[model samples]
Target: MTYEDLPTVPRAEELVDKAFSRAARAGRAKSGAEAQRSMLQTAGNILSDNLQNVTTSWPDFDRVDPFYRELADAVVPAHGDCPGGVDGLRTHLSEVMWAGRQAGHIRDEYQSKLRGVDADLARKHRKQAFARLADVTREVSEDLEALGEARDTLKTLPDIRADQPTIVVAGYPNVGKSTFVNRVTNARNEVASYPFTTKQVRVGHVERDHVRYQLIDTPGLLDRPEAERNGIERQAVSALRHLADCILVFVDASAECGYPVEVQLALRDELADRFADIPVLTVCTKADRSRDLDADAYVSVTEEEGVEELLDAAVEAVDYEIELPFEG
Candidate 1:
């Protein structure tokens, strides 16, 4: 959705009030399951930016070891004693994962499943084999349980229906904050490699597992005081005061700042004073290009681990609830 689709701030505020009023009249279902679901959905919203990184990576590791263990239970006797049994099982399981299920209802159908075997001569033995499939079935169930747990762990991300999480990406000019948002969110916001490419604050929705968060890509850091008649710095100041839910302070932890870490820390201090209530996350951008950037704080790896961690932090925002007598 675009700016046009979203109500103007004043209108949106009015709607929120109206919504709460309506909610007040309805009886609340304070069930623990309901609360757990709401919280997980909300957390999913905050971590939307990093959900793929976390959730996708999770199932991969989560399923692998269990899948191999299950395979060992099923295949060790028939496929007895491969030199590196676990490793071989892992390789086979990887292939199966990539292969996915067979097409359509045939995937669930078992009639033609033993097609490759010479079943005509081995019918009774086949019956005996089917009876012994219990161990394999049990192992398969265990593997599935591991994958389910991983998905559930991600599904339990923090969320509250009334207030959504917001992450403000602030940094020195050209630190790839916009790119980071795009990578995690599949957002199409414009990005440039120049300082101050983003003059205005652009808010994008990062939704994961049905939860939503507002990812605010703000202008670069404001070094000069507000009193100084300024340029990009002023835009940054405006974003600080008005737009962010939580501040993600992006530093040139790589020090393309042309200055020193002292200057960066001073800037951070100034920002803290200005936006004292907003939580600030330090982000060190430009791992691909700048090696000189030193961040004793959270460092971003040009575009990989650094940006990934930043997104996880964005997802980790706390949610608040008023415990309304009517919430369901």
Candidate 2:
């Protein structure tokens, strides 16, 4: 489900240069029509294999986890010249695959033409085949560029494990969402920017009773309504819908967070309706400053008060059951 291991995508010109350069070396090792045939086969195989590798390196969109699939859809196209949507990305991949097959076909056809031909004629046919192969690659240059851009964007995404129970911490700006997550989880939270957005996301983990729970705090998403968000942010929230097993809707009852309690409650209600199947807990933060509002839990990160209790409540709400082996 992670894109960190995806291979770096090479440009069309790089692939072509590599293929032709190796073909020349392969040609030097033989004579007559054999030399020409060797060169053609060498170049063709390199181009075809490399081009195919680009496509194979990407996971099948249909089979990918819905969370990552949607995240990619939101992030990839926002940076580069890639077309929007998963379908558009698939189209670019299909083109690369087509070009790879074309390279193979060109090799086979030129090999046939080499039969019964002298060294000079064989050399001429090999050149023609090389030209055709390069042409095929050049035709899909934009596709290669788009896929390369996608690789760059997707690789930078924060590594959020889909297998573990996830608690998404959300609230308005300065509502102490990040502070609360930092307090509850380990000291080291992985922070990374979402592609095409100025805001960053923080992810942390807490282990209890031999099981791990993930806590993610995303800015610029889940803090505002869908109508107020841009396309990229909206899609990101959509992706979170698939990943969040439980959501902690933090409300700064003190109004010191710069947002009114009523507004925060409305957002909580909206999230509750949107993720109807998931547990949405309303937490009143900055308890030391003020506890003027009612919530499922209250916490003050500054004083380290009620934090553990809040964490226990979130973990219990997740209710993740670990499967045990059956007795023989």
Candidate 3:
């Protein structure tokens, strides 16, 4: 389900150069007419093999986790750079693979034609084979470049466990979401008072009553509507919606986080609408500086208060139940 470990995709020129260079070395290993024939076949085989590596190394979009699928599906083409969305990427990747397969066919045909040819003519045929395969390589260059851009985009995707019961923390920027995550779970991820400090989802784990649970620290969701969100922000939201077993919607009751309670409430309402499948446990944060506040849960992360109680609430909201040992 993780793409960060995938092998690097070579640029078009790099792929071509590597194939030709290796072919030359392999060609020199032979003598006379056979040298040119060996070189031609070797060059074609290298090109096909290298391109095959790229296609095989990439994760099959259909076979990946649903959370990953949603993330990939959310990737929009860069403005004026690529022309289509996730399906476009899928088609381009297939095209690159097709070109690779064609290279092998071209090589086989030239090798057959090499039979009974003189050394000088064999050399000519070898050059012709390289040119033909090179043309196929050129046909796939744009798709390769697009795949490269996809790799860069996918690098930002968070590493999350699919089996665990996950609790996603969400609210407007600077609403103590990160602080709450740090306080409740073993995760010591970065916590700051600044807005948008968490640009991606961060995961942590904790055990309660002998059962483990996952805590997700999501990027702060702005109060604005979904239309205003850019691609990166949309991807983060996709992770939350697709992965959360339960959601902890933090509210800044003290209004010290610059954004008002109304704005935070709007965010909570939006989340409720978007993720209707799971229960949203609304919590008021910064209780130390709080006056009157209204929420289903409340906690002061700075004062180390109500942290476990919040975890207990999240554990209750999960859809499944676990059996603990008998008190006897």
Which regions of candidate 1 are displaced past 4 Å?
A: 1-163, 229-232, 257-259, 288-303, 320-328
Compared with the true structure, what per-residue lDDT tens digits does model 2 show for residues 21-70?
A: 99999999999999999999999999999999889988998898887787
Which tens-of-lDDT digit does each residue in 212-298 have in candidate 1? 777767667756666772434554555456446677766665566454656766777777787788777666666555545444335
Off by over 4 Å in 3: 75-80, 322-328
Q: Over 4 Å off in model 2, which ranges? A: 78-82, 187-202, 222-228, 256-258
RMSD of each: 23.7, 3.1, 3.3
Candidate 3 colliding pairs, count: 0
Clashing pairs in 3: none
Error of 1 at 197 (Å): 1.3
lDDT of 3 by residue, 16-123 (tens): 888889888987799777988888778888888878877898887778887777667666364335555567777777888998898899899999988888988888
| Sliding window of 10 residues with minimal summed lDDT for model 1 | 1-10
Q: Of the pair 1 and 2, which is ahead by TM-score? A: 2
- Compared with the true structure, the alpha-carbon lDDT of candidate 2 equals 0.82
Q: Which numbered prediction scores highest in lDDT against the true structure?
A: 2
What TM-scores do the predictions have? Answer: 0.44, 0.89, 0.88
